[model samples]
Target: MVAITDKEFKQLTEYIKVNYGIHLKEEKLMLLTGRLQKVLQQEGFNNFTDYYHHILNDQTGQAVVTLVDKITTNHTFFMREADHFYFFRDRVLPFLANTVQDKDLRIWCAASSTGEEPYTLAMVIDEFFGKDKVFWDTKLLATDISSQVLDIAKKGIYSNEKIAPLPKHWKTNYFKKHDNENSVLIDKIRNEVIYRKFNLMDTTLPFKKKFYTIFCRNVMIYFDYKTKIELVNRLYHHMEYGGYLFIGHSESLTKEFTKFKYIMPAIYRKE
Candidate 1:
């Protein structure tokens, strides 16, 4: 493997931070090299510096997309953090059921990697609304930075083992088992989620309507303090008043940084 030089590391890390809001620290050099070395080799580059220049000079932006996809971790599973789903179903959905006057529920799953989180969310919403779902616009907008993952999500297919954590009823109702034992999300449930490629580092959000709930989850762990704070504030502007924000349990916001009121560990409400 071609070892990344100090200058190459700095350039790559800075580029990632600026474009993606991901903070790659000095200790992550090995991790970066491990993830990117194969990319460099596949692209016929001999070193990280050459690879960086190629990425900079690539006109289609596909190089950077490939870089981000390879460097960032997309490790997520159905019901990975189960408590947030409980809160969404038991508490947040009830409140929204009463409060959202238009019967249009806008939910954003900001970092939906490979469909697990948003698909799980769709199941919860389906169960919550039951037969009344047709009256409400409960479709979820699930976005992620990587087009690779978004493509996988759009397919709505997964191995049965990957979805084993889902409730039995949900498994039976929302999915169809393939002959190979892989489960494909039923069309009704799959169509309810709109997947898009979104870069969180964009200075302004493009949504015309505010969301009632946003599930950003574990992705923010890669961001630094300033990026996280700024991103949270941006999300605040894009949410409806009293809307809920469900982050990863390991992530937190200090009182000084955000206007969101803490509802529980990893859960906040817009005031």
Candidate 2:
């Protein structure tokens, strides 16, 4: 097993925190060592310092991609937070559908790990609009820093167990059997979500137009107070006025940290 020294650990953690906003504390040394053991062995690096050097030196940018994928957790499932979806369908959608004069219902799933959240949003939109869906544009932008999860999201395939939490009607209408053990999301729902690799730490958000709703859920829990506030401020800048932001129920943005008005336990609105 490759061991990570104190200096090496601090260096690596700081780099990730600064570049990606993923905060790793000193106690996570063992966790980091364990996660990167296979990568270190495969790449012939005997120590964390050497591995860190390789990551910094690699120009193709794939080294950082692999590092982020291995270190970050992407544990999400269908209907992970059911209340947010219900509120989205019941309140947010109706408001957007009626108010947006351009008929462009722009929604962004900023931390779209493996695609479940954005896909759920798309399904809800499809159900809400029903026959008139063709007249409005509801394409969603789903992004994450991990290219690996983004690839899985783009495929839109999941094990039966992974998708078991969805509604029966949703299972019936939006997915087709891929095999005995897995199912694939129908293209109608799949194509509605466009997947991209994005780092939330980027200084400028790369969107030409702002979004009506943004789901930047559970991922913020990994960042520290300062990092979290900076990210929230950035997200606030890119949202349309009166747009809603849905975060994980476990996460909250205190008034000092954000300008978004708290609407519920986990929902906020840019006003």
Candidate 3:
């Protein structure tokens, strides 16, 4: 495998950081080479420099999408962070239920990778409202930068092992076994989540309605401090007053830089 030269590494990493807010450190050079080398070879690129130029000069932007799909890590699973779901069901949903006069609950899963997180949210909401769900609008908006993942998310199918961690009730209610024994999310549940391709680094959020809750969990670890702060502020502006934001359990927002009130570990509220 050809190694990424220092200059090539800088070019690629800087491009990623500036365009995607993903901070690829020097240590990730080997990883990048491993992920991207095959694409370079298949595309008949002689070296990293050529690949870099192709990425920079490609007019269609499809090249960048392919690059992002290959390089960005999208490792997530059902109930990966269980606490946030619990808090959303027990606290956030109830508050929205009582306060939102229109009976519409706007939820955004900003980094919904392979459908688990948003599907789980939909399940919880379904269970929460039960017979009363007909009166409320609980459709969720799930977005990710990679169309590859979004395609998988839209299909609403998972390996048995992938769905194993999901609650038994959820599994029974929301999924059905395909002939191959893989679990496919039932249309009723699958249709509740509307998936879209979204790049977080876009300067402005174009949504007409502010969300009551945003689940952007585990994605910010790839971003540098400034990017994260700016992203957080943008999120705040796009959320309704008293809306909730859920981040990764391992992530935190510096109180000094953010307008959100720290509600608990991995959770914040707009006040």
Best by lDDT: 2
lDDT of 3: 0.93
The models' CA-based lDDT, in order, is 0.93, 0.94, 0.93
Candidate 2 lDDT tens digits, 1-271: 8778889999999999999999999889899999999999898888888899999999998899999999999999888889999999999999998899999998999999999999999999999999999999989999999999999999999999988998899999999999999999999999999899999999899999999999999988999998899889999999999999999998999998799999998999999
Better-scoring candidate (lDDT), 2 or 3: 2
Poorest stretch of ten by lDDT in candidate 2:
1-10
Off by over 4 Å in 2: none
lDDT of 3 at 215: 95
Error of 2 at 154 (Å): 0.6
Candidate 2 matches the true fold with a TM-score of 0.99
Candidate number that wins on TM-score, 2 or 3: 2
> Which pairs clash in the backbone of model 3?
none
